[model samples]
Target: MVLDAIYRGELLPCENNMEGNGRHKQAGKEIEQLLKDLRNNLSEEDMALVDQMLEQTLIICDTECSDAFQYGFSAGLLLMQEVQEILRKRVDTAAHGVF
Candidate 1:
């Protein structure tokens, strides 16, 4: 199943397809401003260290977002399965003329 493929890490999530709302844009702007401040105030060596730190943070965030997406997708599939089971039960009951 496609879900199994995803769970097995065979299918990769597309990060580019993820869209954000106004709050995301605002937060990005805030981060940009902070980075700008750091660039202006910190020494070259310190800025290099900050850049490395940011690179690591980006990796962590990317991993977290991917995991969250997979988890939500799995949850959605389970919900759909539950709905289908409920509908099947209803159909069965109706066929038997049961209330």
Candidate 2:
């Protein structure tokens, strides 16, 4: 079943077709920006963030991935929920020159 899921995902035409592929590229760019913001503090690269999140989320979800792998998707996604909020707050604060 896991193999089937992985296989099915491989065949998704979104790569050659564009039913929903565009969303991911946009999301990727956002993640790239966030990771860039983060890399200012850490030493990791943007691609490294994706690689780490994929590996971590797979371990975290431990689901029966299929063409619709339900492993809930990302380590950073979970982290980002919180981090994004914090960053926003920091930005709001910094805008006022409060540091």
Candidate 3:
């Protein structure tokens, strides 16, 4: 999946149209490992945040934009902010304990 994301230029060091084979396979393997580590270490709240972010991203990506591209970007930014808020709330709750 990470290899596909890299090949599609979704991941950083975005080499456009780079075929994922041979040496590039190593990079893909590394990315997969990193992702696994992230998943393993993530708290439940963090995982929830990731899930929300992905859901919003998918919704935005699927919708057709009649307005300028900036509108879509703005909407995505707002969704990201909401995800941040969720993370913040989780942190605050963890610190204070549930009332």
Candidate 4:
């Protein structure tokens, strides 16, 4: 089932529709207000530089989030494999009357 979903392009980790926590939402609002305030005070050139920095920061954040998701998914798969193997061994032992 999971493989079929992946094959159909349905498993998107980074494209979630969930909202961030309250603290993160508040921080984002504060950042937006700060940017607006800065826009009124800073020169156009400086604002452009700030925008470039923000863009770069966003890129870095996206890369980090993607890498983290990949790592978590790999870890989950390994855990599932381990659980299945343990269960299989238990079943085999029980069948052999080894308790």
Q: Which candidate is the best by lDDT?
A: 4
TM-scores across all candidates?
A: 0.75, 0.33, 0.32, 0.84
**Number of clashes found in candidate 4:** 0
| Segments in model 1 whose C-alpha atoms lie over 4 Å from true places | 1-20
Off by over 4 Å in 3: 1-66
Tens digit of per-residue lDDT, candidate 4, span 1-99 = 979989999977676534566787799899999999999999999999999999999999999998998999899999999999999999999999998
lDDT of each: 0.89, 0.68, 0.74, 0.91
Models sorted by TM-score, best on top? 4, 1, 2, 3
- Backbone clash tally for model 2? 1
Candidate 4 lDDT (Cα, whole model)? 0.91
Tens digits of per-residue lDDT for model 3 on 1-99? 988986997864324435656687897798678768878999989977877986897577546332445686689899999999999999999899873
Candidate 2: what lDDT?
0.68
Question: What is the lDDT for 13 in model 3?
Answer: 31
RMSD of each: 4.7, 20.4, 21.1, 2.2
The TM-score of candidate 4 is 0.84
Q: Which candidate has the top score in TM-score?
A: 4
**Model 4 segments more than 4 A misplaced:** 1-12, 15-20
Per residue, candidate 2 scores C-alpha lDDT tens digits across 10-94 of 6543244545677967987897787677767665576577669878986764443433333345554788798999999999999
lDDT of candidate 1? 0.89
Range of the 10 consecutive residues with the lowest summed lDDT in candidate 4: 12-21
The TM-score of candidate 2 is 0.33
